[model samples]
Target: MKIFVLFAFAAFAVVVFSGRSEVSQANGRYSTGSIDAPTGVRSTVNLYATKVGVYWDTVRGATLYRIYRNTANDANTATDVGTSAGNYYFDLTAVAGQSYFYWVRAENSVTSSSFSEPASGRRANGNVFPGPFPPLDPPPSPSGNSVTAAKASLGKALFWDEQLSSTNTVACGTCHRPEAGGRDPRTLFGDLASRNPGPDGTPDTFDDIFGSPGVPKNNADGTYFDSPLFAYRPQVTKRRAPSYLNTGYSPNGLFWDGRATGEFRDPLTNEVLIAAGASLESQVLGPPVSDIEMAHGGRDWTQVAAKIAAVRPLMLAEDVPGSLRNWIGGRSYPELFEEAFGTPEVTPARIAMAIATHERQLFSDQTPLDRWGASIEQLTPQEMNGLSLFVNKRCIDCHTGSLLADNEFHNIGVRPQLEDRGRGAISNNPVDDGAFKTPTLRNVELRGPYMRNGQFQ
Candidate 1:
């Protein structure tokens, strides 16, 4: 007599046969019966624009493989996408920008194995760069207040003057320097104090942020106070300082969340100064009163105006630009104000206009990319290859245009949305969670430690 037994494992199967011991001496045999499930499955889109390449390790007992796909992660929702004799499949129906999860099953003439672990991928849209560069739109200026040489000069002085801060140590230029591509360079030093624990409130984690350092916590009387987060040390901003270079070109709004609207309103009077196209002017009014950036607690525009009135222009700054120095020789803030505006009286609106005017002059159109696009110069072979890859890989989808940015917000899945609400905080939309504005690539090499949180070097 003989007995047959079959056993199935998670990934393989076995068959056994046994004979009665007394009959022809006890004998045992084992044989393979079922196929193993596919393993080491992965997906990619680097090779083709319209297809997602799904690949896997060849199974020992598989004669053919069946591919299944769905928009969600669940395998139950997946439908048969295709079949292949080899260990790979090209999903031509995969759409660009939309993510798809995939699974593979090994099969032979008799039966099929269970589905393998799922892999996810998406196809690139393959939108190439448009032709030569186009001229950038003129920088917007506030209505009734053009950018005059005198106004820009006054704004330059204010921008670089440390005395504008309540502690007389920080200025607009303290964090934004031209040499560093209008971004803070101090974060590159690896200062532990400059780090802000993200929403998780933990340190040395993936969500840790490298941010710009500002003045310590201060009382309304300009005295230092212990901060809950930093103690006596200088307070750090929640987000990294964005580059000021070429910021004038952004028309929708300013800042990572686009909170700085184009309408410039007088801080004190709430009167609309610039009705539209004055995002630069609207942006300038923020840092001066921000307690963490440049001011003491409860500091108002009245206090800022009074402080400017009391201090001489650029009193704490050195190596002033020659034109500004010549204009400011033996002059007071009131005198500079008189030259910039109609009279010597210092006000918040005039201050914003002057600073915005100065910032508008910081155009960066002389880059190598610009020269190549303009047909004034040629790109190297390596550069041409890089440009080709940049387009082919679909990096140009969001980072498009002459500015190399779409000036829109997108959540690229850099981190979990719970860690940072990002544009969602401003827009109050769940879909905008973790979305950040696309930054310009002009002089990008000079600005290291990129991203809104400065998570990448």
Candidate 2:
């Protein structure tokens, strides 16, 4: 009896302990759940129709969020969308000018969990929320007057006309194309550098005026270029063109340095001698003459004599309204230059003036914040909150809008490895240090590779 009681007790103890172990195994070990928000997020945007803008809740550690938007509009409208790990939301909706309902799920590994819950949203009747920036002053009125239809068209013509260049190949549009976010990227914008010269060489301005009849004029016939043309070498131009999107808003002159290069500097002041020389207007005309960027024959304007003569005829006024009179090339330069600059009157100064004129009028103040602040409509709660954060954070101190830069230069921590002084080299002022021009953030989200060095993030 004693042996039986002892064996029974031992067996019972073993069974109880084993049962406990099995239960624990079923539940797994440690713990698992969702992460909390790492950054602050404005509430979802409620819009004018049934549309709402949906965004993720907690960023936490997740690298991506798979999103799906749907509506009664169509089957194609519903599909998978991916978020950029740290961003608040994805504009992955397919329904244009229509409302949508959306759902998002956060994921760490390729296989994470579902969204916290199905959140609904539809786009509102406005542009997306802009990045933080300052309240810009009202853009200057269309300078002089509203540019006429004829002028605007002419400007675009000269803008793309390669005859404007000394090479008879490049044009204003070569560097500053409206389609290229209004600026040119070397490899991106038709691979121009592979075909052109450096913008600053002296041989640049030697091309015969496309429509003007004369020897490519020297320092004498009111012409400016006469020197060795620099060859195209990317090692020198570390930074490429920024957009000309809203250039008229700039109170200062053109180019990153504020003063146009390639033109004569005051042998005395270096203050960009405009007296008998190019105003900012005239300076705009210099690039096409560059041997490296647009000039030819090793900067010898003398060698490129025929090309220069051909230029004079390009913008010559025609006696017949729609026909080419003097510059009997297959196309007409004057007619087009007339449309963009408010007149067909093409001259060195007028060409630049026309370009400057068109630059002044590229406005698109249609973002969500504009509704609450600048635009005629009102803003939703989230956008209003974003605006509050934008102002309170002092992003406005440097980035003012609709064209967001102050047009001044700052170091802003770019190309730190490069040697030599930056703005100081140009100004020779101790205060100028490494300052580069402040970039305007208009249409910024679309324009990436963020910094001056093309470091995309």
Candidate 3:
């Protein structure tokens, strides 16, 4: 666990190893065939058969690709072909008798969307799916004013409410405790922080935190409330929780594995990708569908919603007319919406915007080091020496910049005893084998059980 102790100084006598990160184009969220080109650039034809197999150039930012082929004989008989995220699909659909049409799209755990254009050729099949996503929003806060106080308050309430959980006992705040640097470290047991059942078949109970029931021989005191949130065995999470501080700055994607992105698909946007770019509010609401996190049993959102709807009134609030009204708001949902977002239409977009507004506020620009002593000029001589050593050891290479993260995944090659795959599971990329994001050292000394694995350095 390379705990960096930074000591910045011009040690003329010492070799200070420091280098800037590659200024790669900002990561984009636009998938192929999704970006809106000018009207003049639109192509009319869908399929042009020229070659034996369909092939296209590599699209940027795509890790998985799919080709949708519709045969000329039938408009409804469409074939779905799945390819790796970065690779183009084979053009096998351009059969001689079939006037085949092809449309391509990109998808990963976080995002899925259509292509911007179609490639046409007289005798050859051409794929016009733009090979990459539209670049990330160039700037932050794409379509709104700064987040507000009332919105943040509502967000905090929603984030912590157990009614949001499948069992109606957990909320976003359960895992992202502020004191533990805004993340849960209680993997073994404790509070609403986690709901994992023990292998010993102990009964769920809040006293030990997981609320697990019947993993034990006789611990179910007959009054414990550890009923399975589902009818089947639960599906534990593949990974642990991530923090929130400084995450809103990551506009293009979210999560260490990027399992979530700013361009989450909500019908409210009508477009597959909109308002993507990291926003604390957006990142915070994720994982309620995870079986081990907040998911209902092992089911997805629909199942979880149905199970909890009777006990949880908030789910029905979706159709109550006002775009922003919930039990949290005293006035009509529309009135609350006007106050929070200046609109009363009550949209998922605005809901996301409001939660995002509150989340961005979680950015902790204030730290003891930031206030009392930091920067090249403010450090004490000893602390400065430590920082210098930190940079010398190549720590600064990853922990660079004001936010102190290059935001790239690297394989530190820690002891791989744990089940966690870090970024590998989210990306399915070999390059990220046993790798994790280089976390921000903004308040490292205050955070413990270091590393995403939390192996206790």
For candidate 2, the per-residue lDDT at 45 reads 42
The residue pairs found clashing in candidate 1 are: none
Error of 1 at 90 (Å): 53
By lDDT, the best candidate is 1
The whole-model C-alpha lDDT of candidate 2 against the native structure comes to 0.41
Taking the tens digit of each residue's C-alpha lDDT, what string does model 3 give over 152-265? 434444555466555555566556655666565454443323344333334363111232221111111212224353233333333445665556677436776665666645
Candidate 3 clash total? 48
State the displacement of the C-alpha of residue 379, model 1, in Å, after optimal TM-score superposition.
Answer: 0.8
Error of 3 at 31 (Å): 46
Residue by residue across 1-457, what tens digits does model 2's lDDT show?
Answer: 4333322221111111111111000001111354322221221343322223343333323445556666643324556664533223436344435555555554554345543434455444544345433223324433332333223333443555566555344566556544445555342322323222222232223210111011122332234454342122321133455666656555555555555532434332344433322223444554555533555433433323334334643343223222112112233455344323435544554555445444443443334333333222554444445445555656567766445467777776554422324566677786666567777665554343445434343
Relative to the true structure, how large is the alpha-carbon lDDT of every model? 0.71, 0.41, 0.43
lDDT of 1 by residue, 193-236 (tens): 77977677776777778889999999877679888778888888
Model 2 TM-score (2 dp): 0.48
Specify the highest-TM-score model's number: 1
Candidate 2's error at 403, in angstroms?
A: 2.7
The predictions' CA RMSDs to the true structure, in order, are 29.2, 24.8, 19.8
